[model samples]
Target: MPADQELDQELDQELDQELDQELDQELDQDPTGGYRPLVVVLLSPLAFALVFASWTIFAVLGVELKALLGFGEAHFAVLLAMPMAIGGLAALPMAALAQRIGGRRVMIACLLLICPFLWGLSHASDYHHLLLAGAGLGLGAGSLAAGLVYVSGLCPRRHAGLALGLYGAGMVGAGLSYLLLPLISQAYGWRTAPLLYLLPVLLVAALLWLFAEDREAEPDVPDPLQESPPRSPPAALLRRLACWRLWRLALVYSFFYGTFVALALWLPAYLSAQYRLPLREAALAALPFTLAVGVGQVVGGALADARDFRALRWWVSAFVLVCLFLLSYPPFVMQVQGVHGVIALHYDAPLWGFLLLLSLMGAAMGVGKGSLMRLIHRDHRDEMALVGGLALTLGGLFAALLPLVFAVGNEWVGIRTAGFMFLYASLIACMLVMVWDHASDRGARA
Candidate 1:
C-alpha cells in the first residue's frame, strides 16, 4: 500500500512538471502582450487572400482582354494559362531560396514582384505586353509555397492544422475576382480590371513586411566527430529533396490540388459548351465549387489536428470518387423496347445537379489537401520549406498539365466529359499508390 502511494505521487509530480512546461511555453510565445499571435495568425490569411486574388485575376479578365486585343483562340487560351504554368515551374527554385533565407522574405518578395506585373498589365495595349506581364505574375505561385512554410513555422503545434487550413482557405480570393471584375469592367473598362488589384497587393506586401516576421528556428548543432563542411544551398536542397516519402506526398497532393485547379479552369468552358449557357452564367455556376473547396480546407484542417488524418483522407477520396464517377459520363440517350411501344431514356445531368456534384467533389478535394498538408508538418516540421515546395511544385505542374489533358480529351478523345474522366482516372491512381504505400509500411513495421 505504501509503495503504491509512492508511485502515484511520482506520477502526479511528472504530470505537474509537464503542465508547468506548457504554461512556460505559452507565456514565452506571446511575449509581445498576446496581440502579436492574434495579429500574425489573422493577418496571414487576409494577406494571402490578396496574393491569391492577384494570381487569378486573368481568369475573370481574359474574355474581355481577348475581345479587346482581337487575339485568336490560341492566344487567348495561352494567356489564360501562362501564369499558372510559370508559377508552378518557378515554385521549386523559389522554395529553395526560401529555405536558405526565410519564408517571410520570400513572401514579401513574391507579393512585390507581382505589383509591377499588375501595373504593367493594367497599361498593356498589345498581346505581347500583356503576355509579358502575365508571365511576371506567375511569381504569385512562389508566394503560396513560401506562405505554407511561413504559417507552419509560426503556428503552435496544438493549432497547426487550423492555422494552415485558414491560410489555404484564402484561396477564396479566386471567388473575389468572379464577384468584383464584372462590376469594375462595367464602371471603368476591362483595362481597369488589372489596376483594381494594385492597391491590395501593395498593401498586403507592406503589411507582411512590417508585421509578419518569420519565427526563426534554432540552428542545428554540428556533430563533433563526423563533421564536414555544410553543403551549398542548391546542393543541400537537392540532397534533402531526394526522398521517396517526399515524392509520394507530392504525388498525393498533385492528385487532389491539381485536379481541383483543373476543374476550376475547365468548368466554365465545359458548363457553357455542354449546357449552352452564357459564359457569365457558367462562371457563376462554377463559383460554389471553389468556395466549398476553400471552406472545406478549414474544416478538414481542424479535424485532422485531433484525429487520424490517413483515415480522414481515405474517406475524402471515396466521397470524391462517387462524385467524379457520376460527373465523368457524357450526355447519353438509350432506347428500350417495351411490349407495346418504344421507350427512350436520357441521362443528361441537369445544370443544378451537375453543379451540386462538382461542389461536393471540390469539398472532398479540399479536405484531403488540408489533412495531408497538416500530416506533412506533423511528421516533417523541420523540413517544411523543402517538402512544402516540392509538393507545391508537383501540384502546380499537374495543375498546369491537366488543362492541356482536358483540351486533348475534348478535341481528340471527343468527349465533352473527358476532363472528368481524366480526373477520375488520376484519382484512382493516387488511391492505389496510397494503399500500396500503406501495405509496405505495415510490412516494415511487422
Candidate 2:
C-alpha cells in the first residue's frame, strides 16, 4: 500500500475500536446487557441508601434538635424541609453535572464531602453552623439526581421500570435509619447520630468508585438534525423545558411524591403529638407507611409492564383519585367495651377516615412512580433530562412543604384539622391532575 493509504487504514482501525467500545457501553445498559454487571447494580443502592438515609435524619430527630437548638416548630419544620428543598432546587444542575463529570465521580465527590459536613451537623453551636451543614448535606444528597440519570441510561428499556423501582427501594433506608438513629441518639445524644452516619457513606462511595464504569454515549441514536446540527447552548435549556409531558409528569410526581415526602417527615411528629406515642413508638408506627410506599413502587412497576398504556394510565390515575377520596373520607371501626368482651363496631368519621385515605394515596403514587416514567421516556425520548429533572424538582418542592404546612396548621387550627387540610388539598390536586390527564387522552384519541 502507498504511505497515505497505510495511514488511512490505521486511522480506520482506531475508529473501529472506538465504535466497539461504544457498543459495549450500550450493551451494558440493558438489564441483561453484558455491561449490566450484577454486583454493581445490587451494591449501588447500598451507597444510595446511605445518601438518602442522611437526607431525612433531621425529621426523625426534630424534637431533640428543636430542644437542643432552642428553635420553635416552624424553625424545626424549616430545618427538616431544607435538605429536600435544596435537593429539589438543585436536581437539574446536578443532572447536568453528572453528564459533565460522569455519575460515579460526582456521587463519590458528594459522598466524601458530605461526611465532614455531617460531622459538623452533629456539633453545630449555632443556627449558621447548622444551616451551612444542612446545605452541604443537601448538595451531597442531591447526587441522587445524577445516580438516577446514570441508572436510567444503563437499564434496558424493557426492565427500566423494575430497575427504577428497586433503586427507589433505597428510600427505605431512610426509614430504617430513622428507626435506628434516634435510638442511638437517645443513648448518646442527637450530636453523635450525624457523625456515625458518615461511616456508611464513606464505605459505599469507595465501592462505587471502584466498581462503576463510565456510561457510554449513544452515538447511533437518530439525530434530530440530519446534517450539521448546532448544539443548543446551556442558556437555551429553559426553552427546551417547554415539553408539556414534563409538566404532566411533574404534576403526577408532585402529588404522589409530595405525599410521600410530606408524610414521611410529618408522620413521626403527628404520631408523637396526636397519640402521645414515644419517639421510638412513633418511628415504628411510621414504618408501615414507608413499607406501603416501597410495596407500591414494585406493584406499580409490574402493572406497567403487564398493561397497555391506556389501561395503565387510567388505572394509575383512578387509583390515585380513590386514594385521595380515602384521604378525604375514612370509615372508622370502633371497639366498644361490652359485658362479655370488647365488641368491635364500624363507624365512619370524616376525620380518621381522611387519614386512612391519606395512607391509601401511596398505592396511587406507587402506580404512577413505577410506570409513568416509562411512558414519558417512550414519548419524549429527546427530553428525558429535562423531564426527569423537573419532575423530581416538583416532587421535592411539594414534599418539602408538608412538614411546614403541618406545623403552621397545628399552630392555627387547634391541632386536629390543620395538617389534614393540606393533605386533603394535595391529594385533591393530585386526583384532579390524573382526571385531567385521562380526559385529555380521551379527547386526543377522539
In lDDT terms, which candidate is top?
Answer: 1
RMSD of each: 5.2, 9.8
> Looking at candidate 1, what is the lDDT of residue 132?
89
Put down candidate 2 lDDT per residue, 51-95, tens digits, no spaces: 777876777887677777798877877877787788788877777
Q: How well does candidate 2 score on lDDT at residue 168?
A: 63
**Candidate 2 lDDT for residue 48:** 65
- Per-residue error (Å), model 1, residue 46: 2.1
Q: Candidate 1 residues 1-446, lDDT tens each?
A: 24654575456446545654674586586665255555567766776677667656666666566667897544655665677778888787787677768777888888888988988988898999977887898778888887787778666666778889888888777777767876787788877888888888778778877766665546888878866888887687678778677776667876787677656665666676789876567667778998998989998889877754667778888899889899998988999999989999999899989898888888888898888888787666778877888787887778777666666767678887877788888889889998998888667756
Clashes of each: 0, 8
Find the 10 residues in a row with the least total lDDT in model 1.
Answer: 1-10
| TM-score (all chains, Cα) for each model | 0.89, 0.81
Q: Which stretches of candidate 2 lie over 4 Å from their true place?
A: 1-36, 218-232, 309-359, 435-446
Instruction: Tell me the whole-model lDDT of each prediction, alpha carbons only.
Output: 0.76, 0.68
| Candidate 2 lDDT score at position 101 | 63
Lowest lDDT block of 10, candidate 2? 323-332
- Which pairs clash in model 1? none
For this target, which candidate reaches the highest TM-score against the unseen true structure? 1
